[model samples]
Target: MTLHPQSRSERDPETHRAISYRTTGSGHGAIVRLMSPSDLGHLIKPFVFLDLFEGESSFIKGMPMHPHSGIATVTVITEGNLRFEDADSGTGMIDYGGVEWMRAGGGVWHGKEMSPGTSKRIQGFQLWIALPPALENASVDSQYLESGAMPEAGPARVILGAYQGVQSPVRAPDGMNYLLVTLRAGESWSYVPPKDHESLWLSVSRGTLAAPGLVDAGEMAIFEPGNDAVTLTALQQDAVFVIGSATPHPYELALGNYSVHTNPQALRAGEEKIAEIGVRLREYLRQPNDSASVPVFR
Candidate 1:
């Protein structure tokens, strides 16, 4: 099952390509970095920002209240629980290795606080998936799924996407899926995309994964649209990654503090809804990231 044994295409490079990550915010309590989706835009159709967060709480406790709209955010906790509450959604906690998906279709107010009385190190990823024009104005909804509830096939954990004849419990819009994969040392796995799938991208979270050449942690490996199944081998005791997507939902993305959409008009509309939600609930909105801020991409 070693990737080394497979006959790699003559035009392909022999090394696993590293995905560049730009450090955004880091302190004693946490490290925040923006994984460059724009650089690998062609390989990753609609998904963006494989944001990685580590360390402790920096806020008076942790991240305060926030608002969102027009996109779905998938939060996977691997090490510590994340305490969250909203004016209407009620309060809840997502434990270690848990996954919480928030679809801010039209608007929503959400907040995350650290587990009370504990300064546990929280490690997780927030994957941003753009909604199609149709769902862009849909109602907002949130689903919290425990880690054990996610489907697992062999060494991989089916987070939200499908792989190897196994599908995730948390179905996504437009046939898209995102999966968390972990391989024991010396173990290997292979998966074929659904017949209509248009692309596949793999991002290693920890340890070394062999795909023709070894791809270490923090790197992204992309595959061209083809009929062949992808094969990956673990070179270390534990290799974890996020493998996902189904149909290619490619679109021109305009990223703002609280929204990921196709145009400025859409972003403006999203913000208006977010404001309306906050005002209706008597809650204050977190300032949106300045649209004029410098780009983090190279």
Candidate 2:
């Protein structure tokens, strides 16, 4: 059956008018930046920086450690799996539908927490969220939830927020919803945004979709600002994608090398904390006796 077709009402044309902006981000390697703070991020704050990544075990295992602060990173696995071995977080495999949420509050260094899993090829998306002022410099927290722990509302796995009364296990911020949805060939679905959620966007990881218009794999599209529902139809093969909607972030973004803050003072504080933690991170990783792969220094 057709979901929310545009014929609902004459006054609903603009609300369900497909998309207004789209992009296939530029990159030469196994990863693509679908949205960044410099580009689509300005249009959608809080929800900033999105990466679509796919790489082999060798590449995934060799990822260098990195540091961040004043923001949180959400990693959703779309295919294969990654192994997380740490004394604190324990050991487990994050496969399709699994999500890892790391709040780089105050400051922290990571990247080695996850190594290549049983799958030779792993693919997923990493999203960076600019935190509110109160949480920007708060304590660091991390959550690793596997597929079975995730909840679904229809075809969508609630990744970061509530949908149709189903709430994700990831304790993300309020005012935003992120979902990972899969549709069989020729299936149609409708997404109704929550109250006051005006920012809307989606990125396709596989196959094609018609929000009444074509959105091919590897491309991201932005819906025109409104609190309305969008109808999506899988065109050819199975469709896998992530969608997000939120209330606009109200603060100016103060950018740093690996941090985003509400203002210059916050940025400076976060960077300072990150730098201090980086020194300890290097020492921990270089130790011959330390077997802990996932180390959090703040």
Candidate 3:
């Protein structure tokens, strides 16, 4: 179903999608909550939460271990780098075009897997997708793909879905596409969604753009719901942003503090699993964490 579509503007609707809603979102410290499950999420469904974060002065060295279930998180680094270490992936830097995908299926506790990199300034977006019923309680799966490992299509990196016959290495679920794109000054690019994927939205991280209407840096805009392609011009400066389109999630968003499930029954089961996992996680954290970083604790 199309959501809060705006009245057609005079601009060529065939070339660019009109904006239905836009927000800079609320900011706390260096992180801006562009979209959350409780706000502006239902309209975007599977695409539930988004955060535009930049650590200017000093990035947090380590984030405390947290739990999540019934969702998958995709992290993209836009400005700087973050250090990632895992026993399977070893050590690497996640810079622009790099990605980290974590499916917190069933239940998982993680955080220290990534520490501060050499860059003093860091910026990126973390997006959470509500899991489908079958995969909601599946086993945890994580992938840390370096910039070189990710596929690209013209000006965009296929972050989590196939584009122009190129596919991302990360094994994300179907019916959604996430892209990280950069347009040089005066450059133009268009994004055509996959079949049946109606939900679409985007957030700018740097420079200004005109998807026919000005979408300045640091703003998130929800497109009038449809499958029409959107062409973006980078105005007079280079523009960098992340765009997402997906099939609307059909389940109710049953949420807990750190989890999202399809129904109340699933949420209760997920919460119980995380609570049990937390007890063991406290013990796991007490041990020396000096070896390789554990990317996921299921």
Candidate 4:
């Protein structure tokens, strides 16, 4: 298998952090949050942090025009449409239950909105995958993959990675896997990590999930590989979660809003690079990409 377990020196645990965000957009799309990936360094490796946001009003909105570098960001929406427009890359738009992936090779800038209509409920997850050192200084670029375009693996909907021989079109510079899994009530599923990958982390979104043990909603758990595989079962009527695991990589991490890096200097450079790109995106801030775009219009 392309995914194999790493040695003791390699096997690492996933560290979970609280969902914290800053208010960014105007009206209702303003909360901008960062998941601390650098807090754990890079042992389990490819994954940096998991950010969850649910906008209740226009004041607590989504992110606005911002830059990212040395990493990839996967935005998966569960409720409400999210409008996305990037000046550094091309334009993108995605609707309810959509997913937008951007590989900020060097750097890229983007803005997102909450549900444009009156439903008012906007729920989603934004994940960060650290870029390899080679691409840390490259020019920024992005690509969008609709939610429907993502492959399904068993009970799990793959948004940015692969599972059970099924794969997602959203490729990552790092050998990483990001999966969104939803299991029906009383349903049980087993996740066998790719041999090259060692650590597995799961975050519960709704309902209850059980591994060898039970994990309730709003909780995060880390599983160590080499012990066969970890199994998850929905304990309630329905449950959903995001699982991420990948091959270990040797890299440093420095994280700031909208970006992740291997070094502090790189982080500072990324900020400056995006600030420069922000000037370009500002021109189109008022314009909205149509529904055809991969970045959703919330």
TM-score of each: 0.75, 0.93, 0.93, 0.74
lDDT of 3 at 135: 91
In the range 190-280, model 1's lDDT, one tens digit per residue, is 7666767766667676788777566777555556565456678889578877777567766777666777776677878888888777675
Candidate models: Cα lDDT each: 0.62, 0.85, 0.87, 0.62
What are the per-residue Cα lDDT tens digits for candidate 3 across 51-140? Answer: 999876255554667999999999999988888887667788899999989999889888878887888899999999999999998888
- Which candidate, 3 or 4, has the higher lDDT? 3
- Pairs that clash in candidate 2: none
If both were scored by lDDT, which would come out higher, candidate 2 or candidate 3? 3
Candidate RMSDs in Å, in order, are 7.9, 4.8, 2.9, 8.1
Best by lDDT: 3
On residues 1-298, what C-alpha lDDT tens digit does candidate 4 reach at each position?
0112223443224312211111111122333332356443244557766666666635334334456788877778766655455444454446444677666866775455222434466666777778888777676555555567777888777776577888777766646677888889998888777777776677676788756455666555555544246767798579878877777767767777767788898888877887777666665555785652223111
Off by over 4 Å in 2: 1-15, 290-294
Residue-level lDDT for 42 in candidate 2: 79
User: How big is the positional error of residue 251 in model 4, measured in Å on the Cα after superposition?
Assistant: 0.8
Query: What is the descending lDDT order?
Result: 3, 2, 1, 4
